[model samples]
Structures are given as structure tokens and as C-alpha cells.
Target: MITPAPNVPAIASTPTFTDTEIKPSQTIAANTTTPPTISETLTLPPVSVIATEVPPVKSTPKLANIEWLTKFRGIPGIGVNPVDAWLNETGTTSDPTCRDTRSPSCDKHYRDPLVDNWAAIRLTEVKIVFYKDELEKLITFSGVGSSISNWFHINRVLASSWTTLVGRTYGYFSLEGDAGNGQRFFTASPYQGCTKDRIFTLVITKQVASCAFDRHSSYPQFLFVTGDGWGYPENMTGIALADSFAILIK
Candidate 1:
């Protein structure tokens, strides 16, 4: 019976693996987590922008009341003998007469109470000029201080006076023009600073007037023409600063 026992191969037993045990030939998979999905989106309000503007400024001075200028009685075409009347009104003694032999004219100088008392300006002398025919030709207001401090007050007074007489404001840009009749108005100033010579003139005669000191040919002559507007002669030098204002009448 022993001999008869066939030599059968011994059967191998199957191995069992525990939960923490891993076989050498087996591969283990890594643990992965699922991602969460978003449901809503965020939004913001839009911004806005805006713009702005501005205005311009003026450089000229304000105009003043010039009623005092019209108060004078010595204005041309006023009295039978305007020169004498003006002298009487101004209470001036005709002691020192302004006589020019070459030119057929007579001039009387005086100090006017109205001008002296005027708070607006300080004028020392007023002169009345007459032609050979004894007709009033020119009335001049003069004697401003030569100081620069007097410029503002003087300018204001003259400007106001011009505005009152001409019915228009005095501007450096528009100095002279035809003021009706055979008359012409002119305004001028010197280029120099701190000088007290300025003149505002109104030519009242139809004929050309002698601006010369005498009948000398070398002297200047003033010719006034009529039109819409007229300007001073180009050859004319110096601004109208005569420290005086003259009104010539017919």
C-alpha cells in the first residue's frame, strides 16, 4: 500500500490579506475629493464724470458823475460878452492880460471860485480868449500840479467832463471824433510817465484856427474837419496833455 501511494504534488495553501496589508505585486489607488460648483455672480455700479466753465474780467475804471463840469457859466455862446461875463463870474481882476500882437486875439486870465472849490480837481487858472471881433473863441481850464499823484484825479475829472460834454465816455482807443457842427473833439496824453501835461480839445470854429503862439509860420496850426470820425494827425507828437482843457466855440 505504501508503494501504491502515488507521488501527487502537494497542494499550496492560498494567502489571505488583512485590511492594512498590501501585496508586493498589487497597486493601491490614491483618495481624491470632489470640487464644489459656484451658483451666483457679483456686479458693481458704473461711475460718472462732469465738466465746468468760467467768465472774463474788465480792466477799465468805473465812470463818475460829471455834473460839475456843466455848471460853469463861461461856456461858449452864453452871454453878450462871454469873456467879461466869465471874468465877472469868476471874480477875476483883469490886471494881467494875455495879448498876442501877431495873432488877432485877446486872452484874459482868472481864478474861478467854482473850479477852486471843486473837490474833484485842482485847477489854478481859467482863461478866456477872444478873436479880433471880440467874439469868444476859447475857454481854457488849466494849472494842474505836475506830480504823478495828480494823474488819477485829473484823469477822472477830465474823463467825466468829456463824457458830460460829448455824451459819450472818453476812451484811449476812441479819443477824438466829430461832435456835430464844424466842431471836432480830441483827447491826448504824453507817452512819458509822471508828467502833468494833458489836453482835451473841442474845436468850435468852421475855419481853421491858429494853434500857434503867434502868427509865426513855424508855429502849429489846428485844422478841424467834419465827418463820421476823425483822428489826430499822424505827424502830431506828444499826447494831448496840456495840463489844460480848452473849449472853442463858434
Candidate 2:
């Protein structure tokens, strides 16, 4: 009685089935499209097709310390003549009170003897030649604004002018510092240095000049002479004047 509790479970009645065909719409809709599947992909690095490179900059020099490296001597002695100037009197050497400063008075002129007419040292003879030597020195002054602890001197200076005392038209007096500008030149009383005393012999190559005879500019100018020795400005002024001139001190 327990045998096989009815595999079919005892349907009210055993039924028989007949096979049928599927509809056209049903088969077409299900199979017409395909399903997506698992797969792989790819990528790349960074770079530029049109690229370029770059660099840096530079600097320059200072002129304050080396003021003497330039064409301070001015125009050459194209028309200057020569003279014979030597120390006379053979007196003991003395220090100059001139202090490199000048005034309108003839007595205080750096180049004037105490007596206006007393020739200090006749420099008109070699004034131009001294400048010629100076020209050589200037040739090497290519430092432009670079510094130069230079020493300009003159054993003596004569008039560069042919007629007037210090005018270029007739003669050249002496050169100031650079351009007739005051910054170009200076003259303090002699002090102890390699640049003291040699004012008269200052073969200063880089200097300019301003003259009552032929001034280059309106600014006051001076002659800076420093060297190994001092001279008697008094004797230099009276008759033994280094020459007849008025110079502006710093």
C-alpha cells in the first residue's frame, strides 16, 4: 500500500497532450539581438611634438674707484710748438700753499709767478710733447667704466696755446679731470701717498682742461696732481711759478 506514493500523484485523470508550433514574433524578438561579453582595452604616455629649451643673463663693471681710465687728456697737440723750460734759481724745494686751488688774483694762479710776468718754468717749449706722451698712455685706456688707481703727473706744463695763455685757439693751458666737468678732476693739498708732490711733473694722461682762453664747458674744473714730493706754492706763485695758471681744487 505504501508503494510509490504515486509518482504522478494521482491526477484526477491521466491526461494526454498534442504538440504545437511556436509563434513567429516570439522566436524573432529573443534571438534577433546578441548579448554583450567580457573583453580587454589599452592606453599611452605624455609628450609634446613641438618643444624648445631656454637659458640665462649677465652683468657689468663699476667706474667710481678708477676714474682715470679714459680720454681725459683731450685733443692731441696737432698744432702745438715746443719750448725749453728748466728750474732756475736752484733754491731749496718748498711745499706749495696753492693747494691746487685757484682765484682771479694773479698771485694765486697755480701757473703764475708771484710777479705776473716772472716766468716760473718756461713750459711752452714742451707742453705739446708732454701731451704726446700722454696720448700714448690714453691708447691703453680701454677699460671704459672700469676702475684705475692711476697717477697723472707733469715735470712741468707750458702753454699749449700758440698765443693766448691757456686757450686752444692760441695755446692749451692744462686739462682738468675728464670732460670740463668737475667730476673729471680734483686737487687737494699734497698728502703722503705715491700720488703727492709731482703736480708740476704730473704727466697725467687722462685729464681735460678749461681755460679763460678756451673753456670747454661752463662747470668749474680743476687739476688733480699727486706725487712723491711737495713744492713751495709761494715760490711757485711769485717768479718761480710752476707756470701762470689758476686751478680749481676739489
Candidate 3:
């Protein structure tokens, strides 16, 4: 009985800032292919008010490039939290060719390195409204301890919270106050999954705010993939999106 061994999954190429071909399930062995790396930078507005006047006219959180869109994955019903009906999570079955809309799911574990996808499509980039905590910043950041300004940007990321029923993983980045200071802030993080084969990339530099990863290798079967996109927590709701779109290149 010459039973052939189970075919090892493909060893897909590393992710690139501009690579359009994507796939599902990949597996690189020890001393195998190198994973891709990514990073991103966000342009934000200033946050300073030193007025002794009383009327207290407020300003909207000015964010550039706002968009709104939707997605459809297999695990969850329909995702309305991020936006409207176009977003979904309908492809969580064992079937490799299930209806995979690509919307972020609150539950259900998805296979990575999928045989059907290579890139994410933009859904929205418009604006929404959220009421931020109006508490006054009592700490007056000055000379010696003046680095207090940078704290705002860093803190926004650290203090975000979300609870997923499917136990998915994620990461996010955005400029803090650099936009106000004529500088841009960038944060990059990789997505995590239950698979030890889990991998992602994050790169932060002068004019780039991008990230990339593969749940499985392009060298592997997309049907067997297992990972999620970088996390976009719910706390970011009503924060206003600039513009968005989705893509299917492979």
C-alpha cells in the first residue's frame, strides 16, 4: 500500500507593501521562507487650547480621509458596529469555498492563507461621530516634564478595550498629536492567532503607515488557513473614518 504522505502546505512569499496576490493556509518550515513586514502612519489634527475666555466653543475632532464601508465574513451574522449592511461575516464553515465576504467577525475562527484571497478591500473612509471624554487635562506639560504631549498619542492605544465572542486577535496604530505638531505618528502591530504558525508584520517609518501578514503560506492550501486581520477595536467607534475600499487581488 503506497500511501502518499499528506502534502505539505505551500510556503507562500512574504507579504509586501504593494503585493496584490493573496492566498489562504501557508506553512514555512524551519529555516524556510522569510515572512513579510509592514508599518503605517496617520495624519491627525492639533489638540491645544489655552484660552481664559468662558463661552467655550468646541471643535470637532478633525480627521482627514474619512470613509464608511462594509464586509461579510462567515462567522458572525452581519457587522453593523463598524458601519452598515455591506459588512458581514458569512464564511465560517469547514467548507474551503464558503461565502467569504471578509468583514471582521466578532466570533468564529477563520482559516488563513486562504486559497481565495490575497488582499483587503477598502469599505469606507468617511466620517462618523463619537463623544470623547470631555474631562480637562489637568497636567500642564512644561519644560522638564513637557514630554506630556506625547503621552496622549501613546495612551490612546494602550487604553482601548473590546470583547469578542469568537476570541479573535488584532492590533492597530494611529498618530497621536504629531498631526498637530506638524509631524506624523505611526504605530504598527501584527495580528495573533491560536496557531503557533501565526505571523504578521509591522513597519513604522517617516512617510509610511502599513502592516502585513499571512495566516498560511501562499505555498499552502488556502482552505486550511487560520488567522485574523490586525485588530480594530470597538472603542474607535464614532471616531469618524476618512474613506475606505475593499480589494480582491490574487
What tens-digit string does per-residue lDDT give for candidate 3 at 1-250?
8999999999999776434543332323533665554433554344443343346778775433333221122222222211111123222233333333333323332333331221232211211111112211111111122121232232222112211112333233222312321111223233233222221111111222121222211111111111223322222211212111121111
The lowest-lDDT stretch of 10 consecutive residues in candidate 2 is 78-87
lDDT of each: 0.30, 0.24, 0.24
> What is the Cα-based lDDT of residue 24 in candidate 3?
38
Cα deviation of 227, candidate 3, in Å = 15
- Report the number of clashing residue pairs per model: 8, 51, 78
Any runs in candidate 1 off by more than 4 Å, and if so which? Answer: 1-104, 109-111, 120-225, 232-250
Tens digits of per-residue lDDT for model 1, 1-250: 4668789998888878877887654443323334444433433333332222234466675332222232222222211222233324432323222212223223322233443344455534332232222322332333355221222222333322232323333433111232232323333343222132233443232323333211223211232211123223332222121212222111
**Which candidate tops lDDT?**
1
For each of the candidates, the C-alpha root-mean-square deviation to the true structure, in angstroms, is 21.0, 21.0, 41.2
lDDT of 3 at 146: 17
Per-candidate TM-scores read 0.22, 0.16, 0.15
